[model samples]
Target: MVVTALDLVLAGLVVGFGALVQGAVGFGMALLATPLLALIDPAWVPVPILVPAMVLAIASLLRERGHADWRGVGWAMLGRLPGTFAGVALVVLLSPRAFAAAVGVVVLACVAVSLAPLRVRPTPPLLVTAGLVAGVSGTAAAIGGPPVALLYQSASGPRIRATLAAFFAAGTLLSLAGLGVGGAVTVDGLLHGLLLVPFLAAGFWLSGPARVLIDRGGTRPAVLGLSAAAALLLLGQAVLG
Candidate 1:
């Protein structure tokens, strides 16, 4: 696909906005960028987006380093390895439309889980399970934050943001590796991702002030609303397509 100047500009802006959302909240870059980019070209989905996502996750980790939970991050990564393999298989097997629809369904389900009033302790087993879910979601759709985010919903904001950042840093790398193994990470996607880095940085920088304004209870409502809306939009697009 030809990379027009407009494509670059639009992609940059979209990524920037998504990055801002992620910075203020915890994770939504892929959820916000994927469907929009898919409209530009399907080639811009998982691989291209994952590049900036990894960058964003690292930046988030550094920004909120004090609140990271390394043990939980470790458990998540352990479960993510096999889930990453499963995600690669799904990518190789499913048609584009079918893949999109499946992703939409899973995202919607995750959002539903987030919105529920259920209480979940972050036990090792549950963390591993969340990690597995995140691995598949991250690899397949670049929207892996929900499973882990939902699990940590009742925690402090800093912990939630920082811990998620840590997990995503590792998870995004694994997803990229999985994509590489599947021959999905093309040169064009990488180049496009590089072009959007500046915008992502800008968004992350701007998020600091916004984060201060977000109240304690605001995170849950914001995350849940955005997740549900994004899932609905994804599902609607897949269904209509």
Candidate 2:
């Protein structure tokens, strides 16, 4: 479908909201964008909407993490590559509804994982394991944040955001490359994803202040809100069946 002006506006707003959540917690670009955009125009959701928006968001997101998060990011990237290839391959083979349902299931599982206890802080080995899981799940589903997110739940605020951002940045770049090589990315997807750039920028800017709120100490609300919102998005899609 040629996007109507109203559809553009709706997509823009959805991008903005997703960005806000990213600013708030340092993830959620795909989490927020995928479901909402899918609801709007399933035609656009797969490549047009996700491919470019995520590419831009990841590019902008990684600057701050730099040297600090490299080791973990590297490990995650290693696993993420093959996993993402597997995911895109699945996308090619599966029917559209099957793909959407598969994504929904993975996302919902992430929500449940997030809600569980992280009382025992993560060790390096755990981070490595998370990276492997993230790589596979994200490659297939395009929702890799949960695996890394769970890994970082016990860290300080800055560490959490920076690490996750770095992981996403690298993983997305890999996924984008694989998708492009597979000829999964088309001009239409590029244009649609490009249109959401403003929203992505807005989210980046908004993160500055949200970072303050995050720095103040309490993170229960942020975690709770994201978990609920993500789960709701998935459940809504499943119920629409």
Candidate 3:
């Protein structure tokens, strides 16, 4: 498939904005960017998007390395192993429309849980479960942050961002490896991802200011709102397509 200039421009903007959100709130890039990128070009999902997401994760992690919860990340990584395989299977088995719809459902469910008054502690078992869910969603749809982010909604902004960054930085590699083994990775996807790197960098840089506002009691709302909006858009696309 030939990608037009307009496609690249639009995708760059989407990725840049998603990066800004993730950089500020700790886990929104994929949730906000994936459906739109899929609309721009279905081939941009998963591999291409995961590339930039991984880069942003590393950047975010380094910026707040001191605040990360390594124990939580370790537990999450444990579950990510099996979940990634499941996500790879879905990619190989489902049609694009079905996959999109499934992702929409999962995201919406996560958002609903996040909005409820239930308080969740990041216990080892819960972290592992969230990691498993995140692995499947992140690998299949490039929107893994919500499950894990939801677990840290009430935490300090730096901790939330740093911990998620650690998880995604490592988790994305696992997903990419699974995709490559499943034959979902392609040269075109890698090239497209590289093309979007500058945008990701720009967005991450701009997020410095936004981080202040978000840290002052804005994290939970941003995470829940962005997740819901993106999920709705994805569902609409699936239905329309």
Candidate 4:
């Protein structure tokens, strides 16, 4: 489907809002953007969103490069490759209706997991596990950060942000390539994704000033609220589609 001007404006707003959250919390762009974009048009999931997500990931990583944990990033990448391929297989096999439903389920599950009081140490084995989960979740639904973010919740804020950003950057690229190989994404979809870059950049820019506000408190509630709303929308689409 061709993305109309109205679609571009709506998607830009959604991407901007998501980028705001991500700028504050380090890892929620997909969780916030993917489901809503899917509602706008189910075609917006996976690669369309993944393309912009990678760009955001790179920007975030570069901004916080000093704090990035290279060792952790390395381990995560190890698991992400295989898991990404698995997700590619799913995209190839599943029908659009089924895929939409599954994306809804993933959004809900990720929210549930985020709300749970689970503490995870970012060990190599654990990082690999999180990476694997992230790869599958991200590639399938563009909601991959929860797994890796949960593991890094205990780390210093900057470390958590930078490392997760790095993982996402690498993981998103792999997912995109896999999607390309599977013929699930096309140049048009990627171009559509690129169109949202200006909005994403705007959000990222505003995030710098707004960071202090979210840093104090309310970030968790805000993130959960957005995730829940998006999840509901995605569920509705799945049921009605």
The candidate with the higher TM-score, 1 or 2, is: 1
lDDT of 3 at 131: 93
Q: Give the per-residue lDDT of model 2 (tens digit) for 17-115.
A: 777777667677667777778778876665665654465446445645552466766776666766777777776886545654655565556557666
Model 2 residue pairs with clashes: 48-189, 80-135, 84-139, 87-140
Model 1 clash tally, residue pairs: 0
Supply the TM-score for candidate 2. 0.81
TM-score of each: 0.92, 0.81, 0.92, 0.83
lDDT of 1: 0.82
| Winner by TM-score between candidate 4 and candidate 2 | 4
Ranking by lDDT: 3, 1, 4, 2
| Residue 36 error, candidate 2, Å | 1.1
Model 4 misplacement above 4 A = 94-118, 217-241
| Predictions: Cα RMSD each | 1.9, 3.2, 1.9, 3.1
Q: Which lDDT values do the candidates have, in the order given?
A: 0.82, 0.65, 0.87, 0.77
Over the stretch 1-241, how does candidate 1's per-residue lDDT look in tens digits? Answer: 6778898889889999999989988888888898899888777787778889999999999989999989999998988999898888877787656766766676678667665677765779988988987787678777788777877777877888899999999998899888898888888888878888999999999988888765457887776776676667657766787
Residue 142 of model 2, lDDT score: 55
Cα error, candidate 3, residue 141 (Å)? 1.0
Q: In model 2, which regions exceed 4 Å deviation?
A: 51-63, 66-68, 94-125, 224-232, 235-239
lDDT of 3 by residue, 1-241 (tens): 5788998889999999989988999988887888788789888887889999999999999999999999999999998999899889887887767877877797788778777778877899988988998888788777788778878888999999999999999999999999999988899888889899999999999999999999888987877777687677668867987
